[model samples]
Target chain A: NAGVTQTPKFRVLKTGQSMTLLCAQDMNHEYMYWYRQDPGMGLRLIHYSVGEGTTAKGEVPDGYNVSRLKKQNFLLGLESAAPSQTSVYFCASSSDSGKLLSYEQYFGPGTRLTVT
Target chain B: DQQVKQNSPSLSVQEGRISILNCDYTNSMFDYFLWYKKYPAEGPTFLISISSIKDKNEDGRFTVFLNKSAKHLSLHIVPSQPGDSAVYFCAASWGRSYKYIFGTGTRLKVLA
Candidate 1:
């Protein structure tokens, strides 16, 4: 089971250009998240979905949008890319929300984006 | 505000020795703490975790200790192996929150 997979391993976009990154998980997880990893900064959550069709903004959700149309798929979109958006994006999924049952999240390889 | 912080950017330990990585958080409300290891060009993988009710949790050679009063948490690796060398990050989450705040990350090197 490809625990989690991300599309477009690498991409380059100019300022104001738009693109979307897709994430798919075969584990049938109930929760999915999108995070950006920047130099000297660890993973910062941009958006997350507790269940299919439900989404929420995270710590650094500005300049980013997300949609969870299917249970296995989560999409992150950059409407107008900026130089600051250049970073590695990671997608993860978990069976539980760590409230009562704490489950470790499974992460995808990650997509490297460079916005010039 | 950087609620979670890993002060040591990097650390090196000799093979077969004990390696300790530290993390501190400013939020007392955080009850769940976790540790993750990441290699170059890859996503972070779960290492271990501990709830606030417990002070220590052990899994094989890796253990996590939490000091609620000091608001600090640490990961200890015994008999460190070269394969264990990687960037380690500490994360924290509060009640009913779906998000976790992660530390900057500490790079560990097990030297032979």
Candidate 2:
């Protein structure tokens, strides 16, 4: 199983450019999440979906939006890129909502985004 | 506020020795704790986890000990191998929230 895979391994955008980072998982997980990792900082949640068509904001959701149209796929969108959004983005999925079961997250190869 | 914290930024241990990594959390609502390992340019991988009801959980050479009273947890790897070298992150989640709070990773170097 590919487990979890992310598209556009690396991206460079000028301020105001819009783009989407795609995440696909084959694990048949019920939960999906988007997180960004900055240097020397812990990975922070941006948004998540308990199931398809369900979305919720997370700790650091500013400048980012997410869509989970299909259970196997989750997309993170940056409508207007900013220098502050330059960081490594990660996508994860789990078997359950993680509240009642193991919250163990399987992450994908991160997408490095740079805005200048 | 950062709920999870790995006080040590880095730790070095000789090959074949025991390596202990520590983590602490500030939220009492957290009922589940997890540890993840990451290599350069890669995302964090789930390692081991311990529930609040139990103080210790073991899997192979990796063991996680939770001291709920102190709000501290530690990971112990015995006979550590160089391949175990990586950045370790601790995370916590509650029973009602799906969001997991992560700690600034602690980089471990298992010297050969």
Scored by lDDT, the top model is 1
Candidate 2, number of clashes: 0
Q: Fraction of true contacts kept, per model?
A: 0.52, 0.63
Overall local distance difference test of candidate 2: 0.93
**Model 1: runs farther than 4 Å from truth?**
A97-101
| lDDT tens readout by residue for model 2, B1-112 | 7899999999999999999999999999899999999999888899999889999999999999999999999999998999999999999998856679999999999999
- Superposed Cα deviation of residue B63, candidate 2 (Å): 0.8
Docking quality (DockQ) for each candidate: 0.65, 0.69
In the range A1-116, model 1's lDDT, one tens digit per residue, is 77999998999999999999999999989989999999899999999999999999998999999999999999999999999999999999988644562557788999999999
Interface RMSD of 2: 1.6
In the order shown, the candidates' Cα RMSDs to the true structure are 1.3, 1.4
True lDDT of residue B105, candidate 2: 91
